[model samples]
Target: MSVIWKGVFPAVTTKFNDNDEMDFAAFDKNIEAQLEAGAKGIIIGGSLGEASVLSDTEKIELLKQTVKTVNKRAYVILNIAEQTTKAALLCAENALKYGADGLMMLPPLRYLADKHETLEYFAAVAKSTPLPIMIYNNPYDYKIEVTLDMFEELSKYENIQAVKESTRDVSNVTRMINKFGDRFKLMTGVDTLALESIFMGAHGWVAGLVDAFPRETVAIFNLAKQGRHEEALKIYRWFLPVLELDIHPKLVQYIKLAETQTGLGTENVRAPRLPLVGEERTRILAIIDNAIANRPELPAGSWGVEA
Candidate 1:
């Protein structure tokens, strides 16, 4: 079955309580806000969602809850960021068993597998489950670049359907289109580069900041798709500072704090990843507050029209 992988899909954060347990109340509230704000899909257990820290039980429960909360209104994608092929396959199988509509998988976690190893690994997981896969090609963060040559090899798989292109090089968007055409549905993975990627013909955005400012994020994509570049840029210029938080080392904490300020969720994160403190916390809050204080009034119309 072909999944139409288009529109803004937020790499949502996993909410936790002060006691370090998954906070279902906050989690469900965030999901409802994203769906209500017209996000095309919700991605759970991603790097933004703190996948590395979450246990298998927690990951599975999150997937099940997201699938239940979305209830066919939007796609629920489970991010598989495991180290071994075996573990990756197991997660894929479990995601399917728990009702994930699709998956967004990174290359071999932490090992930085080479071209041949990466291709084989993705091919294995793609074959393990029938769910459509979005290959996350974020060389900047993951240190593994899924080159055009590797994509060519993986393209033979029927289920490897989309890519979250986050090389941080906007030109790579054109390069992928120039080479593969539509074999892989290209979704811009970086929050800051979203408008440029859309302008360059990317099919969608797997966004980060949308967790806090869903309407503006959706508005930028829809306006650009509608050829309203001026309107989109107006929002984009105002949105740039907050979007930068998505690329930071402390993105989970930063974004969660933004969520709290916006009344969407809490700033509570798991241990080893404490909440932002001191001046850093104050600075992030100021950025979010300034934007909120001067938040642009979105043009009146329906948003999130699929590209």
Candidate 2:
């Protein structure tokens, strides 16, 4: 439970092969790149990971793989987006057994839980595990906002230490800070708004585009944290177009394609999510490739491994 719950934690995409099987080798490469770029943790089986199609066993296996791949270099957090509190508890419990350091938990999906129900569900899972939890409050997408009042109640659980804040409204960052102060560490979840969120007092980023451009993502946060706003903004501007990909419905496909272009991963996503094709594919590639061509140079100092 000693996780920092800050910095660039990638909501990683689950790497698959053309056969649609889990491709650990491809997965490992991207992970190595993440670590090298100084990600704070690895959030597996998130929306970006194609979590819905992955079975429970597969999720567990993914956790095991991440724990091994990370090798104590960073935190390995499993995303729990289940339909029932019972199932989420089971997932969180299993995550602890497999060496996960923390969890990025959403409200019970499929049901669109109301406030009381959402609070109860989160409480059940929070009390179920000793591992620290970062409750994901993304109302726009998930249809459940873990409001300040809800957090006031959940704050009783010591392990519920952080939040993946994706409310889309930057002002909410200040509101949370105004009420809760330091009770919950905040990590921004949206890629497009990440730099602004961080400047507004978000402690870290549960980043999406980091799957492909880990260095730039990490550098933005690292530099901004150091009060190098001018430098951070420079990279963020060049990064804007590519960062928008994370907000798309086909984000998994879009990011995987970016990974392939970067030599960090492949474009193979799980089924029901076919690889991006035709005009859409061409359009997305234009954005990614264009970013690649005009990528900015980070400050030549020790930001991380290569700095």
Candidate 3:
């Protein structure tokens, strides 16, 4: 069967109530909104969803809730990135049981792991699940680099089917496409570089900011797929700055704040992560507000449409 994960799949946000508890209702609403707004599928419990702070019970409950809410309208992917293969395997098994379309995993991050350790971790997790798996290789955030050769080597696993290449290095993507071709699905984890990736032969994009602007992100992929690069690049340039914040160390905070300002989602993130404030917060808010205010009056999927 073909992979169910192609196109604009947003790394969804996990909503919390005023009491700082998981708001099942709000989370439910957000899922429906994204699907209705034309998202191809939705990703849960990733960096955008604050997967690190959530407990195992929380992850399971959220996955169950997501299944119940989305039903079968859109693809549901569980992001189960952990430092240990044990955790990743358990999470993948549970996710598969709950009807997740696929699994996305990040590399071991607590300690610096060698190429051998990393490959073994993925192989173990791949064997643990029946579902297809996507390796989330974001070297920028983890400071752990996965060389093209290492990635090429790991793609041999039966279930290790896709790579979320977030390094934004064009050459890296080019090499992967040249070496692997259709053997492994290559998706861009960085939104700003998404168009370039498509032109270079990426299968899809795993976007964090899609929660706020589904139409824009979806347009980039759809347009480029149709060979409408001139049109796609325009929206790419417009959405670039706002999308850059998603890669920042303070990504969750800025995203939460932007959601609040847009009436899209809440700004209430769990502690150890605080709300944006002072000049930095102000600058960020202004950046988002200005984008929205100055945003062109384009129709849905207009990013792909010519002016």
Candidate 3 structure quality by residue, lDDT tens digits, 155-261: 76777888888876867788887887787788888876777888888878888777777666777777777777887888788888889888788888888777777
TM-score of each: 0.98, 0.98, 0.93
Which ranges of candidate 3 are over 4 A from the true structure? 299-307
Could you give candidate 2's per-residue lDDT for residues 242-289 as a string of tens digits?
Answer: 999988889889999999898989988777788888999999999999
Better of 1 and 3 by TM-score: 1
> Which 10 consecutive residues of model 1 have the lowest summed lDDT?
298-307
CA RMSD of each candidate after superposition: 1.0, 1.3, 2.4
The count of residue-pair clashes in candidate 2 stands at 0
lDDT of 1 by residue, 13-118 (tens): 9998888899989989988888877888899999989999999999989998888889999988999999999999999999889999899999999797888899
Total clashing pairs in model 3: 0
Residue pairs whose backbone atoms clash in candidate 3: none
State the RMSD for candidate 1.
1.0
